[model samples]
Target: MTDTDVAPDTAAWRTPHGTSQSVSQNHLAGEVWMLLRRNIREALRSPVIAFIFPVLFPLFAETLVASSYARVSSLESFPIQPYTAYMAPGMMLLAGMMGSGYSATALVLDVQTGFLQRLRLLNVRPSAILLSRIIFDALRVLPAAVVVLLVGLALGARLESGPASVVGLLVMCSAWSVAYGGLFYIVALTTWNPQAPLAMSPLFILLMFTSTAAMPTSLQPGWLASLAHYNPFTYVTEGARALMTGPVTAHALLPAAAVLVVGIALTQGFVIPLFRRAVER
Candidate 1:
């Protein structure tokens, strides 16, 4: 046959058929499970390092502040259930930040190593990469949180809220973790520099200090208090705190929801275009 008369290999060149498409769809699911397992394995390999912050921070705070605050009636006015009630939210935020930051750094490494490009060329779903990273982050934080919670309970930290509140708190904390992870996605997508995560470090520190983590807003300077009042993290901490303590406040819950919504929108806005550019590059 003449060259023009010869048909192309339709089987090879054509788009994936039913089984192939099913496999492609399942690719991400399989990868997610594998990625999660890998993350757990890595974390297990470094137990002390992984557990240090989540476990110790709450204990230290409870030991130091819980008694002093308990003695002072003025400070005691704030819902002071188990010191864990206050400490848990802060730990949650810290875990979220660390997880997201580390995930972003990992993304940078993947980009540098050309893994991102290889993944892009494959039939993997784009969302799966980000989702898996987030899942890994959440799972990484869980062990630490569990350790801290157990310690807190041993230390007489009580949860005044019902089962629903406990579930809600965990769910909200997870959402916060995912939202922060998305923010990291933006950072990783926009910057190629290995040190880019450093830019976020100050912000993380600022968030911890500005919120109700270390001290009540009433104790903070007026200007600092105002900033914290407006800070979205303040809401998250407050909401989580309310969930643990008895007196749930509208002030905390409303702002937390608002912040979550705004964060999701802002992160997506930046991440989508940044991801596209990174993929194209």
Candidate 2:
């Protein structure tokens, strides 16, 4: 049996060193820590998934697109000088979104291998696995997000808001990534089909292009502008841009925060039940 499968000593449990509830909580915490470490190691082992695609690919795309569109910012209607500055925040967000597929696919592999079933047999709490996966997925984006931002800086994207805004920007990206990734998790759990999440993966590209990611809403065509106005990603991108660039105000950040809160509440509300049902089967 694996380390996770080895139960704590029964005699130790009977001792009064700790209350049963406290001991159980400690046990769950240990399990989560171990699982999280495993997940992180797995991610690091695959550099393509862990870094290249999420970091380099987005940076490349941003660089190419921003270069081609650099002159767009010279228009009187545009506010930012270099197009890369306008695109950087959205590209960083894109880096986070791109990694969601791997996270969902990893969960599918665990299901196919009966790992979750084994954990269940060991009396591991579902919450432990869920928390570990969620935390891992949230963390998986940070390195890529930071790299993309740094690349943008090299490409002449200025962070007018100063150093402290970096924290806020990363936090916004992480929150949005978690909330966005929950959809893939729900699909993976519900269908138990590894291809399901990957199949719908184009939605990430679609959402990014349909939002204010490529250009400010004012420059978009009327139909596209209207669509972007309703896209949740628009708020996220706008908020992230505000943090990185300027206009650090509630009017800029509140809508994004609200959208993230609601999205997390809705998606995670479904993910838990779906995950429980999938593992039990």
Q: Which residue ranges in model 1 land beyond 4 Å of their true spot?
A: 1-59, 64-76, 81-84, 248-251
* Candidate 1 residue-wise lDDT, 161-270, digit = tens: 76677666666766677677676677767777656754675566688778777667776789989888777788888887777665677876888878877887787678
Residue 5, model 1, lDDT? 17
Clashing pairs in model 1, backbone N/Cα/C closer than 3 A: none
RMSD of each: 8.4, 4.4
Model 1 CA lDDT for position 60: 61
- Report the C-alpha lDDT of model 2 over 1-281, residue by residue, as the tens digit: 23342233212233466544333445777878877877876777687866677776678778887899889999999978788999999998888888687888888888776677656655667898899998887888898899999989998988899999999888887888899999999888878788888787678888898998889888999999999999999999999999988888899899989999999999999998888888777
What is the Cα-based TM-score of model 1?
A: 0.76
Q: Any residue pairs clashing in model 2, and if so which?
A: none
Where is model 2 more than 4 Å wrong at Cα?
A: 1-27
Q: What's the lDDT for all of these models?
A: 0.63, 0.82
Candidate 2 global TM-score: 0.89
